[model samples]
Target: MFRFFRWFRDFRRNRNHTLSSSPQPSDKARSPCNQPIVEATPSWKFDSKARWSKEYDLSICHAEDDIIYVENLVSYLELQPHSLRCFLQIRDSVPGGAMSTELCQAVRESHCWILIISPSFLKDPWCWYQMQQALSESPTANGRVIPVRKQLERKDYPQELRFMYGIDVRLDKDNGFLKIKQAILYYLEELCAKDREEQQQRDSENLVDEATPQA
Candidate 1:
């Protein structure tokens, strides 16, 4: 028994010595538990492609009186560096198409809707209809609706739009438009992040399936 115990102790000591003498990767070169470190690849990049299969980046819902001003805003958005596709009922609508169909499609297909809440807009029945339609499409809002208050009074602010924050362009058109552009870009980036996460999940699932053995 004494000899057996001695042998066991010597074996343990030799094993320890052998392990200590073996060449091992440093902590910096290897992960915890001696696993090889793998550098994570970047999963996303900024691109000009449409986000989430949306047809247009922005849909302008405004009164006929605001068409000229909306056109200028559209031009700014569509120009280089911005290059945002916008749905304008006046400019992009099919010729002889029903007005209701055009308005509904514009609100439905766009990633975001901009309600130009000018005085004329408040008075226009069609503008009010579109505003309600936009709200119905995105009840929680969720960065989908933007209300631009142009030459409108505080008392005249639409009751339905009171819940969400809006940009007031009554004072500075350039500054307001810039803010609008930034908001749209921010929303698009968020959508892109979601898309990337979904893609990563799919890739991981594929890898798991490939590694799984057949019965």
Candidate 2:
């Protein structure tokens, strides 16, 4: 009995330490344990007995250093095994800025870009560059580009990027966060759909090219 109680206390302390230390944005500090969203939603969206499982999977990137926002978004989505590996423009330990080649590789490798956009983000060259990179690589949902807004308007977006869709996250708060997560999931599903379309298009093109006599 005493032994079990001691073990439980130690286990909880260890978890607290482990979670607090993981390299994340400073917003995490402000995100209280009893955030308003937590009360509105259940303790765990899934089973209390079975381990909770969240379905939204997105390769996220943070633009406005929304670490708490990112954290809460993933939490509500019930991200399992943490599929979304979110990044700020630069990690705290690293001294140098991420270059074009690095950005290219990240955009190419990642399935989606969940950028937190605000007036500040629009002004930053790197964020715009990252958005452009996503546009050049996988322009649609497969290689998706999502802008989660803080207080910016869609109309203000550069004309070149007007066509792309973004996750609407303004004063809506955590519900806004949930909407962003859901949007990512929708895009991921679209990615699966687009894959089939891309394959068929390639097949048709190949047949047409093959059928034509060699020059």
Top model number, TM-score: 1
- Give the alpha carbon lDDT tens digit for every residue of 101-188 in model 1: 8789878889899999999998899999999999999999699999899889978999999989999986663637666766787777
TM-score of structure candidate 1: 0.75
- In angstroms, the error of model 1 at 186 is 0.9
Runs off by more than 4 Å, candidate 2: 1-57, 64-67, 74-78, 81-98, 140-143, 190-215
lDDT of each: 0.73, 0.54
Candidate 2 lDDT at 44 equals 29
**What is the alpha-carbon lDDT for the whole of candidate 1?**
0.73
RMSD of 1: 25.7
Error of 1 at 116 (Å): 0.4
Which digits, one per residue and each the tens of the lDDT, describe model 2 over residues 127-169? 7787777777666544367767666776776665566666566
- Positional deviation of residue 185's Cα in model 1 after best superposition, in angstroms: 0.8
